[model samples]
Target: MGKSSTSVLVILAFFAIYVIWGSTYLLNKVAVQELEPFMLASCRFTTAGILIFILAKIMGIPLSITKKQLWNTIIAGILFLSFGNGVVVWALKYVDSGFAALEISAQPLIILLLMRVLQGKKIQPMSVIGVILGIVGIYLLVSQKQIIAKEESITGMVMIFFCMLSWAYGSLFVAKADLPNNYFVNTGYQMFTAGITLALMSLAFGETWSAPLSWSGGVQLSMVLLIVFGSILAFTSFNYLLKAVSPEKVATSTYVNPIVALLLGWYFLDEQITAQSIIAATILLTGVYFINTKKTLAIFERFKR
Candidate 1:
C-alpha cells in the first residue's frame, strides 16, 4: 500500500478499534447479567479465535511458527488475554462498564512505567508528572460513596488494577520477544493460543453451556459481534496499523478508546456521567499525553539517529 493509503488504513483501524473495543465494555456489563463471566468470555474468544485462524489460513497467511515462538505466544496470551481480559470480564459483574472503562483507561500510564522498569527506558519528567495527575484524576472520579461500596466496587477496582498490570507486562514482553515475521500469522497465533488457554480453564471450572433458548438469542448476537468485529476485524486492523504506524502513534488509540466507551455507555445504558467523571477523563487523557507523546516529541531530536 502507498503511504497515503496506509495512513488512511491506520486511521480507519484506529477509529474502529476505539469504537468497537470501547463498546465492548457496555456489552460486557449486559452479558454478565445473563451469563457467567469467564465462561462467556471463554466461549466468545475461543470461537472468534478459531474463526480468525481458519480465515487467515484460507487467505494464505502462514500458520507455521517455531516451538520457541509458540511458547512465547502462549505466555503472552495468558498474561494479555486470559488474565487481562478475564479480569475485565469479571469486573463487569461488580462494576458498571463506564466505571470499569474509566479505571482501564489508566493503562497507558501503567504500560509506560512498566517499559521503564523492564526495558531500562527513561521517561521524560513530564511523563512522570502526567502519571501522578492521571492517578489523582481517576481517584477523584471513582471515590464516590455509592460507587465505592465496600466489597463490590473495591473488588472490581482490584480486578481492573491487576488486569492493567498483566496487560502492560504482556505487551512489553511481545515487544521484546522474537516472534513470527508475518503480522497476520502472529495475530492468529495470539488469538488461538489465548483462546485455547481460556477455554481449557473454563472446562477445568466445569462451566456449563446450558443457557435457555430464550437467552440464546442474545448469546448468538454477542457471539457474532465478538467473532466478526471484535476478534477478526479489530485484531487484523490493529496488526495492520502496527505495521503502518509507529508504536507511539498507535498507542494514541488508548486515549481515544475511553472516550468512545464513555459515550457508548451513556447512549446505550443511560449511564450518567457526572462532573467528576469529566474531570477524571481530562486528567487521564493529560496523563496519557505526558506518558506517550509530549516527552517523546520533546526528546525526539536526541533519538533521531
Candidate 2:
C-alpha cells in the first residue's frame, strides 16, 4: 500500500476506536442488563469471530497462521477480550456505563507508566505534569461520596481497574508480539479464542446460557451492534492502531470515548451525569491531552516535504 493509503487507514482506524467504541459502553450495558455477562460476551465475540473469518475468506485473504502466531493470538485474546473487555461488561452490571467510561479515561496514564517501567522509556517533563493531573483526576472521580456509598459500585470499580491493567499489558504485548499479518485475521483469532474462554468461564460460574432469539429486543439489538461494530470494526482498528501508532497515542481514544458514552448513557439510558463527573472528566481529559500532544501524528505528515 502507498503511504497515502496507509495514512488514510490510520485516520479511519483511530475514528473507529474513538467514536465507535465509545458507544459500546452503552451497548454492553444494555446487553448485560438482560443477559449473563460472560454468556453475552461469548456470543457476541464468537459471532463476530465467525463473521470476520468469513469476510476474510471471501476477500481471498489467507487464514493460515503459524503455531506461535496462533498461541500469541490466544494470549492476546485472553488478555484483551476474555478478561479485559468481558469482565468490563460484567462490571457494567454494577456501575453506570458513563461513570465506568470516565474512570477508564485514565488508561493513557497507565500505558505511559507501563512504558516507563517495562521499557525504561523516559517520561518527558510534560508527561510528569500529565501524570500528576491524571492522579488527581482519578482521585476526584472515584472519591465521590455518592459513588463510594454503594458496595456493588465499589466492587465494580475495582474490577474495572484490574481489567484496565489487563488491557494495558495486552496493549504493550501487542506492540512487540509477532502475530498474523492481517489485522482482520489477528482480531478474528483473538475474538474466537476469547469467546470460547468466556463461554467456559460462564459455565463454571453456573450462569445460564440463553439463545440470542430469547433475549429482550433491546439486548438483541445491542448484541448485533456489539458483534458487528464493537467486536469487528473497532477491535480490528485497535490492533491496526497498536501496530501503526504508539500505544499511548492509541489510548487517547479514552478521551473521546468517555464523552460519547456519557452523553449516550444520559440521553438514552437516563444515566446521571453528576457535577463531580463533569469536573473529573475535564481533568482526566486535560491530563490525557498533555501526555499525548507531543506524540500525536500529524495527519498530513506523509504529504509534507
Deviation in angstroms for 201 in model 1? Answer: 2.3
lDDT of 2 at 8: 99
Residues 1-305 of candidate 1: C-alpha lDDT, one tens digit per residue: 69898678777888777888777787777777788777777767777677767877789877788999989877877887788887688888887778788887777678667767866778778777877987898798779777876688899988889998997777656655767777667766777777777777777878765453556576667667766787777766765654454344455566667787788779987888888888888888887666556557546324322
Candidate 2, run of 10 with poorest lDDT = 296-305
Candidate 2: tens digits of C-alpha lDDT, residues 1-305: 99999999999999999999999999999999999999999999999999999999999999999999999999999999999999999999999999899888888888878877987777777788888998898898899999899999999999999998999999989888999999999999999999999999999999998877788889889999999999999999999998887787888898899999999999999999989889989998888767766443342122111
Q: Which stretches of candidate 2 lie over 4 Å from their true place?
A: 295-305
- The clash numbers for all candidates, in the given order, read 0, 0
Model 2 residue 271 CA deviation in Å: 0.6
RMSD of each: 2.7, 3.1
- Model 2 scores a TM of 0.96
